[model samples]
Target: MHGPSPRRPPMRAGSLRDGMTSRRDRMNHVVLTGDRPTGPLHLGHYFGSLANRVRLQDTYEMYVLIADYQVITDRDLPGSIQRNITELLLDYLAVGIDPAKVIVFQHSAIPELNQLLLPFLSLVSVAELSRNPTVKDEIAHSSQQAVSGLMYTYPVHQAADILFCKGTLVPVGRDQLPHVEVTRLVARRFNERYGEVFPLPEAMMGEQPLLKGLDGGKMSKSRGNAIALSATEDETAALIRKARTDSERLITFDETNRPEVANLLTLAGLCLGRAPRDIADEIGYGGAAALKRLVTEAVNEFLRPIRKRRAEHTEGDVRRILAEGNERARERAVITLGEVRDAMGF
Candidate 1:
């Protein structure tokens, strides 16, 4: 017989500060993650980092940054960036990230973070910056004929974002590993030169499944193939209906032979919390048309509540939330920057 139902762990009685020597001495790790406010977040972003952020918020001292400054590396439209920043804030709240638990702020609002970037630039060489594969890949895809200095040095700015908060953990995909590496390198170099001021941040790599666009390419707003989180239920249905699928009579999980059908199945599996093969097996006899219909319905159902919640918030509400978060973030950044300045004799 099964052993008596497993008992839950007993709760500790004393205050955390009483048990610990200092509030800072308590060893909870800080996590830093973010998105550039270039456009509205979508399902691709949700699976990539948003869902993971929700899971990790309670366990870690979470800092969610909206990289408004980083958005200018390619875009010059201030109005568009401003609009997207508000949208990103609403999206974060709609996805269940409690403001009380998570520190969400605009990247540009933290002036100290930008101040920390100055010294970090000197610690890293131009050659090393040029060697970052993520930067190189981005340059190749970017429409700009020549890369800007800001684009080349943005990784160092990212290092400041991590070190400014003494972040120990960063959640990122494989493609973003290079940026995190730069942050680690900058941290080590600064510590060696001055003193041990910043924690060496490590990558918390997750199984970030990249979702494809309806056109079977990478999901992107610029490409006009993405199904945005802000999309209405009818809009989501129409987008999925037009998604590319092969002429296969039976559903199968053959990425090589049936990528389009496989993509649809992957989407359904992610939304429904089942394996792609399991989804394929269930829909095996239904054919491609039936499979598409199933995916469309599932996606709409999943987004219904999220869309409704997003609609409830106004622009003014987002601004108020952001103003409060910026004040809180500045206080934390000030403490870290003070430590860094003292270490460097600034």
Candidate 2:
């Protein structure tokens, strides 16, 4: 049941190794997810996670983070860290994630997340942190001699993100399973080293498969294969035209044989709530050009409402909403910090 599955940790279970039983079943439900605010949310993000966030908002005390601190690990500029906050909010609003029910907050505003980072860093050895491939990959890619301290301890910031809210579930993709494990280890180690102040958050893996970019690679901004939610209809159509489909005159959707066409089909499927194969069948013998046309239409139609809503969210209003949400988040966070200080005689 295991491979290089990244030393995965499940909530309510890690204490088994430490011989400390937890009453996790009796606790109230809290869920957390969001972005680093380095850029806008693309279809990959929307298809992969945003819609489900709307549903989760109803069932959980949802807390969405604009992880500004995490962006410095990869980002080159500091200005985007500040501007992307409003851009991220618009993306969230465009995707139908209701801010009323959810706490839309930023990492910088909640100083408790950074404060929690200190004790958490002490709980785990550097050897344990080095074992995480994410950090290793980051260090390998960095322009610096050694990675920045934030890059090295990104997982701890994430651990702080989840535990500060005492969040029990983090909705994420498969690539992020390791980060969740790091968070779980951090939580368990903190509790073992200190007191049981935070719950170990489980990774509530999303049902949606990873959507591919037009270039037939995993969807990412760095790769230039993503379809940004903020893109115009003409822009999407033009991008689809350049999508790296096979030379097969007739369009077919087999991810193994034709990943480019499959990517387009998958995008259409997510928008229409149909299986990719079904969309593939519908486009049978229609030719790659026709498939591209169909996909462009679907994506443009899907984004119509989103773009409209985004336009309505003026910069000032976006700031006001984030400011209000940040205040609410800080209120909850400061309360948690006060308890931690009291518990530790700080």
Candidate 3:
């Protein structure tokens, strides 16, 4: 004689070595993951990596890096880079990324990562870098324009990021497997040449690692198709209100054919913790309008507390957090660099 269960609320949901501990937990394997601070983090980022980071941080010695250096590879906006760095930090905190649990540090602050980059550069061949699928896809996406040498060699830099922190687990999308492969190659070459200073990093992909963009493309800020995590309720509603859907009056999840509607369904399902097909079935013959409205409401509900928490943090708070992270990152960098220099007889 019980009534139907009420709908549940949406689930609210790094760094690096500046917060390193002197404990003997170094024997425990560590995870290193990060994002380029090119723009605000979006829902795509949430499902793609942020969600996984939140879960993994509790179990692993997590190092979440704000890849400030990597941002300069494609663009030359120094001012935007600085501002995005802070924004990125705020986004991390807003999404329930506990700094105390994960050492969230900036990539550039650790000079050891850069030093490792140089030695790794010698290990990877230009042809090898060119053969990377991500590099080719990115370069092609950048309008086939002339890219900086750094842009071309970024996979090697990524390897430096992983090995510099001795990261063993790198959570990434399936498409990023090549980057992790190169990291493994670089680690093996270095270990074979000098000594086993780094562990071979492996790619960890979640069951659903990617979330499509509003425009039925890859969710990306550069493409202007992403819904940022810090977007206001109104902004989120507007974005979903504008999301593309098929002309079919009936709501259904057919990702291969009805990709756009399916994408919205996926977003709603993720926000509400249900399957996309379940949502599609619930909507039934209500058509795209009803589907959009439900998705908008679910997305806004999810973002409400996150936006509120984000508003509470000021620029000064972000700076203090980064500074502390930088210090901790430097501590580990110093130790790693000294060992590397010794091994290389530098």
Candidate 4:
């Protein structure tokens, strides 16, 4: 029903290669990062990526995408997606991700960006897609008995998310490295088959890439082990109270044997900006209760300003930010799509 829109005359071969090189050089500083709007972000998100995003915005040209379409990749569409998007924006703002400095946009709003998936999907084989470890893990853990086609080619869709923005720096945890590798492969293959119309994005890992859940498993909103960024002080305390800590009275940061205890220390240390072992030493004979009390206090204190900022925002403010960001993202997507179309001689 739709076709490649009219674009400028294709660049000459030599000039096109030169243009690609120039664009790649400029794109080296562009950082693409985002989260799925399935639920409110939690402490794991804070230490894992949100904190790093706040720090990176000042140094790089950052684009924070709300991956709305990815919500249904492993499950049915959630009715809370609309509210979740607003909450995600609030979380981003509360954590000092200045919308003025960062382009925060929703995925479903940009048709041109999704349009990239068709071309990108063709560059990779089904076998290769099946071989992606992340995809395999997701499928293994998924509730659905049968995986959707969208879930299968998720890596390629991610490639579109990265390449559509000419994003060369992608912030991801170690587990997510494979998805970024797929993006790089698509970029390399596309360039080899057509022309260099994309920049191979590099994955940027944060200092603390993974944070454990309260239950000593992966901290996830769906798993009910994470404390949301918007959680009240009382709510945070209640959650931490239930956090799985061992019966060993003496507090020590031994991650191997005493992982649960170490996790509590890690959470407190992250909030206090100190070493977990130091925090453990400070709570020497006090044990889990004392450690829990300290973590609750430290976490609540650290989140006070962020909660205040979150409370200050209204739904109207969120809509305005999304509008401005969507406009900017669409502008970039249009230009990138046109270049891709021209390069493919469409």
The sequence of per-residue lDDT tens digits that candidate 2 reaches over residues 77-175 is 555566778888888887677778888888888888789888778777778787788777667655555566677688877888888888877777556
TM-score of 2: 0.86
Name the top lDDT candidate: 4
- Give the per-residue Cα lDDT of candidate 4 at 196: 79
Q: Relative to the true structure, how large is the alpha-carbon lDDT of every model?
A: 0.78, 0.74, 0.79, 0.82
Q: Decide which is better by TM-score, 1 or 4.
A: 4
- The Cα error of candidate 4 at residue 225, in Å, is 0.6
Q: Which stretches of model 4 miss by more than 4 angstroms?
A: 1-28
The sequence of per-residue lDDT tens digits that candidate 1 reaches over residues 1-346 is: 1101111111111121223133354357787888888778888777766666776687779888988898867544444888889889888877767778888899889999998998899999999999899888777766566678988898998898887778877776557778888998888899999988887776654353567888998777667788888898788888888899877688899888888888888888777767889989988878878898889887777776777777778899888888988898899999988988898998
**How accurate locally is residue 88 in candidate 1, as Cα lDDT from 0 to 100?**
90
**Candidate 3 per-residue lDDT over residues 127-161, each given as its tens digit:** 99988999887777663257778877999989888
Q: What's each prediction's TM-score?
A: 0.87, 0.86, 0.89, 0.89
Q: Model 2: which ten-residue window has the lowest total lDDT?
A: 1-10
> Can you write out model 4's per-residue Cα lDDT over 5-120, one digit (the tens) per residue?
11101111011122223433443378899988988888777666666677667777899999999988888665589999999998888877888898999999999978899999
Clashing pairs in 2: none
lDDT of 2 at 24: 56
In model 1, pairs of residues that clash are none
Give per-residue lDDT, candidate 3, residue 210: 64
**Model 4 worst lDDT window (10 residues):** 1-10
